[model samples]
Target: MQNKKRLMRVLGGGALYAATFFFDFDNEILNIAMFLLGYFIIGGDIVWKAVKNILRGQVFDENFLMFIATIGAFAIGDYEEAVGVMLFFQVGELFQSYAVDQSRKSIAGLMDIRPDYANLRRGSEIVKVDPDEVMVGDEIIVKTGEKIPLDAIVIEGESMVDTSSLTGESVPREVTVGSELLSGCVNINGVLTARVTKEFGDSTVSKILDLVENASNKKSNSENFITKFARYYTPGVVILAVLLAVVPPLMYSDQEFTKWLVRALTFLVISCPCALVISIPLSFFGGIGGASKLGVLVKGSNYLEALAQTEIVVFDKTGTLTKGVFNVQEIHSEVMSREELIELTAYAENYSNHPISLSLKRAYGKAIDNAAITNVKELPGHGVQAFVHGKEVLAGNYKLMKKMKIAYFKGEIMGTVVHVAVGGEYVGYIVIADEIKNDAAIAIQDLKTEKVKQTVMLTGDSKSIGEHVAKKLGLDKAYTELLPADKVEKLEELFAKKTEKGKLVFVGDGVNDAPVLARADIGIAMGGVGSDAAIEAADVVIMTDEPSKIATAIRASKKTLSIVKQNIVFALGVKGIVLVLGAMGIANMWTAVFADVGVSVIAILNAMRVLNTQSIHNSTVPAWEGNVEALSNA
Candidate 1:
């Protein structure tokens, strides 16, 4: 609506300026009055803003520059040029406003995840209330097509949720009983009853919204430089413009005051600095918005700027590169078939609640019959022994086999091995380990391609497991058996190794990783499965839990910085040439208007390009599942 009004004013002023041009009134006073009317219609706000700023001791800004230059043109009796320059300037301001709004909307659209209302369930009665009013442990009902209002754990029903708003992935996620449901996801196809786990203020949606809203508060080095440049640059240019108008005309008897005054006004118009001041920050803003679309949330432009200089990338093993959940990897059987061996072992360990036991049960893929098992005995440091269908069965580590005097072959494998012994005879062993994420290898390789100096992994897992994963992922370095404090200490050492201009990025998802995450130059947390502490400590959060997004974030930061540099150089270079030309009386008010407004519009258009993530989005492969070694070598 505001833009419409501005557009109308521009059109009205433009028509009047055309009338004065084509059908000039013979009387100079009548022609000047018509031009003044047109000028006030288009640039009245600029004049008002200049007056208000001058009263407030903020004497030199774009508003002041435009006001002084165009008013001088009118004073020189170049009425058409004065009103025409103001008209073009107003058009530029309108374009700038529209560009900024579009950039803001691109970011705002990503944060459209905030739920307005939550359906609270109260013993057969359902009430709709604001999301803030929903408390933890309260039961909430989410119907199909409604957003999950708060972070919750599903208590009943099954459905597919559209997580694209949060994760930027269009594929719907399946949520069933006991599944953790984050706020902002749309429940697509079922009515779900869920127990809220966090209050609205602490919910995922709120935190993300708060993060994005506050992102602009932190400024990058380029933005700070531009601010300081404009502060001193504007006043300096104003003084120089004043001297150009006054001293040159007084010093030379041949030079007329009006000619020097017109050149001075042109100089002032070209000196606006709107291009650099506006486009640089706009570029960073667009980059952050683009990253959010790729499921990477940059906390601020400062972190986004630092990301471009990232030299070292450190990773946590569990919940980062690997799926935190353990799964059976391989089954080696001698006497029994793979299925029979796993089934018997699953029955023996069915009653236990260990992760290995759960993995065994999951591998079995059938309901366990407790009636078939009898007299189960658990060895605290070893394993479990139970009777399955009257046959003596044991499923444990090598210690259990040694303790039972059973001859077992201990295979060389980089995982937790569960050996099985049936009636004092060695059957086989099953290997269970945390599986690496589908994109883990790709993430590591892409970081290297981004010119990262080192790709390192820090884990509390055993040396063998860590080394195996590091080798499989083709990481440059691996430090295993490190405690939380040890990871921080190691990060400090790595920090010292980087150049002063380079930054270190640490990625983790566990609570223990919070300290190291906070200690690093930049911390990236996997928001989907990340602990609250880790996420809070992180500078960047990957909402989709993909390690590859780290590379995507770096790519975005570099592109944004490149755009900023281009704007600065281009704005300065063009303005410098035009300022010199205007001072020499070779350039007119029209050239000055183009230098200030045309450059700004073009730079803004270039900045807007950062918001288009299609090229960046399409660059990533689905999942690099080939040989990590071959890719690393390549």
Candidate 2:
């Protein structure tokens, strides 16, 4: 409604200005009145704001500069030029408001993910209430097409959830009993009843909204410089304009005060600084909005700037480069058959809930008979000991075999090895490995194509496993057997190796990785919704676990920075050249208006280019994927 009123005022002022050109009113008083009516219509707010600012001792703003220049033009009998300057300046202001609104729309669209209400299930009755009113441990019923109101564990029903809002992937994720469901996902297929695990304030959607809302407060260095530049630049130009007007008439008796005053007003019009003040911040804001469209949440422009300068990208092995879930890869036996070996290992590991043990049981794919198993004991960092069918069974690492005085053969394998022993005799070993993510290799290649100097992996896994995965992915270096503290120590070493202006980025997806994530120059958390600690500590969050998005983020940041630099250079370059011409009277008030307003419009349009990120996302595939495919064909 306010915009509509402003638009009407601009149109009315513009119509009056057009009248003077077409119809000639020879009466000077009548012509001046008509022009004054037009000027006050569009520029009244600006003049009023300048008055208020002056009263408060906050003078020399863009409003004050525009008011002084246009009012001076009226005083010099250039009525048309005075009103035309205000008309064009208002047009430029309108364009800036529109560009900022468009950028905001990209992020505002995500606000729909916040659930309006939740269906609370209490015994035989279901009641609807605000999502914030629903407490943890309450059972919530999510109907088909309803957004999940809070983080929960599914207790009944199965459905496909549309996680595109949170993960960016369009594929629907299947959920069943015992599956964890995050807030903001839509229940696409079936009704589901889940026990709420978190309150609305701590849910994924709430945190994401908070992160995005506060993102603009953390400005880049370029934005800070522009703010400071404008602070000093505006007052300095105003003082210079005063000197140009007063000193010239005092120095030369023949110099007319009105002629020099016109030049001073033109100088003030050219020196508004609107182009630099508006376009630089808009460029960064547009870039951030574009990134959010691709499901990448950059916490601030400062982080975006740092991401563009990343030289070394360090990664955690588990849940980062590789799927943290283990799978049984291979099995070898001497005294027992393969099936017998797996069966015994599965039964021995039945009581343990470790990922390695779970993989063994999953590979076994058979129900265990508790009557046949007895006296199970799990040793930390080793393995499990139990009796199956009256035979003593020891299933663990090679250390367990040596502790039992049983000779065992260590196989040449790139995985975690669990050795099996029967009645103090070595039987066989089972190899369990964490599978590498599909895009891990392509991600590494993309980073290299971006000219990253080093790509390193830090892992708590054994050396053999870490080196094998690193070699497969073509990483520059891999440090294995690292604890959480050791990963931080290694990051410091890598940090020292980076160029002074370059940054080190660490990517991880675990609670233990929070320290390293916070320590790095820029930390990116993968599968951000799955880990609260990672999301809290990371500077940027990749909604999906895809490593390729790292390259995508870098590309976005670099493009945004490029646009910002272009605006800075283009705005200043044109303004600088024209300001000199205006002072020497080579440029008229018309040219001065273009130098101030026209340059601002052009810079704003250039800044809007950052919001069109479809091309950036389309080019996110790393260059290595194509080269490797070509080599294979040869």
Candidate 3:
């Protein structure tokens, strides 16, 4: 609607200006009247803004430059040129407004995830309320196609959920009984009863919305430089225009006053810095929107700029490179079959609530009969002992087997092992380890392709396990057996290895990693649905919990920076050339108009390329590969 009004005004002014060209009016007063009417019709708002700014002590802006240049053209009897310059400038402003609106729509699509209403389940009744009114622990009913109002646990029913708005993955995830559901995912084809776990203010959707809304407040260094450059550049050009108009006419008798004044007007028209002022920030804004489409949330443009210059990328092992879920990977048995050994170990470790015991129970995948088991005893550092079917079964580490005088074979495995013995005979062992993420190796390989200097991992696991994972992923360095404090200390040591302009990035997803996340140059937290410590500490959040998205963020950042540099060079290059020609009276008002408005429109169109992320997809591994080694503990 606003663009329509602006178009109508420009057309009205252009029609009046064309009338003066074809219809010859003999009276000079009548021709001047027609030209003045057309000029004010197209540029009335700009004239009003210049007046308001001058009253507020804000002088020498783009509005002031346009007002002085066009009015001076009319004073020199170039009425058609004055009207044409204002008409073309208005056309440029229209294009700028439309481009900014399109860029905003790309980002505003993320705001559609904010839920408007939640269906609260009252006593034998359902009531609708705002999402903020919904409290923690309240039972909410989500019908088909309704967004989950808050983070919740599914208590009944089942459905396939559309997580594209949150995770950027098109495939719907299955949610059944006891499944955790995140806010902003739409429920498809089922009615679900869920218990809300967090209030709306603290939900995943709220945090992401807050992050996106405030992202523009933190400007990049390029944006800051452009702002400061315009502040002094505008006033300095105004002074040069005054000297061009006044000194050239007074010093040389042969120089006509009107000719030098016309040259001054052209110089002022060419000096407006609209392209740098508008397009640089828009480029960063489009970059942030592009990253969100890939399921990566950058909190600020400053962080996005820093990501492109990252030299070292450090990772926390558990819940970052690995799945952080304990699983039974292998079972080796000699005395009895694998099934019998697993069943007896599951019974022996049943009464214990440790993760290793749970993994064994999960491996068994059957109902345990407590009536057949008796005299269960748990050692502090060892495993457990129990009597299964009137036979003594011992399940523990190698220390327990050695204490029981059971000869056992300790193999070279890079995981936690559970040894078993039945009736004083050696049985097989079960290897339990946290599984590595499916894309973990691909993530490391992608980082190397991006030319990152070092890829490192920090873990609390033992040396052998860390070295195994490091070698599998082809990392440059691995620090093992580090506590939370030790991880920070190692990070500090790695910080000294980067160049002065380079930045270090830390990625983690646990409460223990909060301090290290806050201390790094760019802290990326995996799983937006993860712990509160990780969410609050990170500068960037990857919603999909995939380590590969870090490389995607870097790719997007570099693209945005490339566009910014292009706009700066292109805008200044054209304006610099025309400004010199205008000062020498070689460039006319039409040429000055192209240097200002034409360059602005082109720069804004170039900045819009940052929002196109189809080319920034997952990169394949390169033909050349790095050697796999645990290079340093640091």
Q: In candidate 2, residue 479 scores what lDDT?
A: 99
Q: Give the whole-model CA lDDT for all candidates, comma-separated.
A: 0.89, 0.86, 0.90
lDDT of 1 by residue, 1-634 (tens): 9999999999988898888869959997898899999999989889999999999999888899999999888888888899989999999989988988988888889779989899999889999999999888999999989999999999999999999988899999999999999999899999999999999988888888888888999999999999999999998998999899999879998989999999999999999999999999999989999999989888899999999999999999988898788878788887779999999999999999999999999999998888999999999989999999999999999999999999888656778889999999999999887777878888887888899999999999889888888988889999999999899889989988899999999999836788888888899997462246645778999888988889999999999998999898899999999999999999999999999999999899899999988766624554665433221112
Q: Give the winner by TM-score: 1 or 3.
A: 3
The model with the greater lDDT, 2 or 3, is 3
Can you list the residue pairs that collide in candidate 2?
none
Q: By lDDT, highest first, what's the ranking? A: 3, 1, 2
Model 2 misplaced stretches (Cα beyond 4 Å): 22-27, 110-112, 618-634
Better of 1 and 2 by lDDT: 1
In angstroms, the error of model 2 at 614 is 2.7
Q: Model 3 off-target regions past 4 Å?
A: 373-375, 389-392, 402-405, 423-425, 528-531, 622-634
lDDT (10s digit) by residue, model 3, range 1-634: 9888889989999899889889999999988999999999999988999999999999988899999999888887889999999999999999889998998998788556999899999999999999999899999999999998899999999999999888788899999999998898899999999999999999988888888999999999999999999999999999999999999879989999998899999999999999999999999999999899888889899999999999999999988988877878778886678888889999999899998999999999999999999999998798888999999999999999999999998768768889998888887788888877777888998998899999999999999899888887889999999999999999999999999999999999947788899899999998455356656789998888989999999999999999999999999999999999999999999999999989999999999999888877778664323222111211
RMSD of 2: 3.1
The deviation in Å at residue 63 for candidate 2 is: 0.9
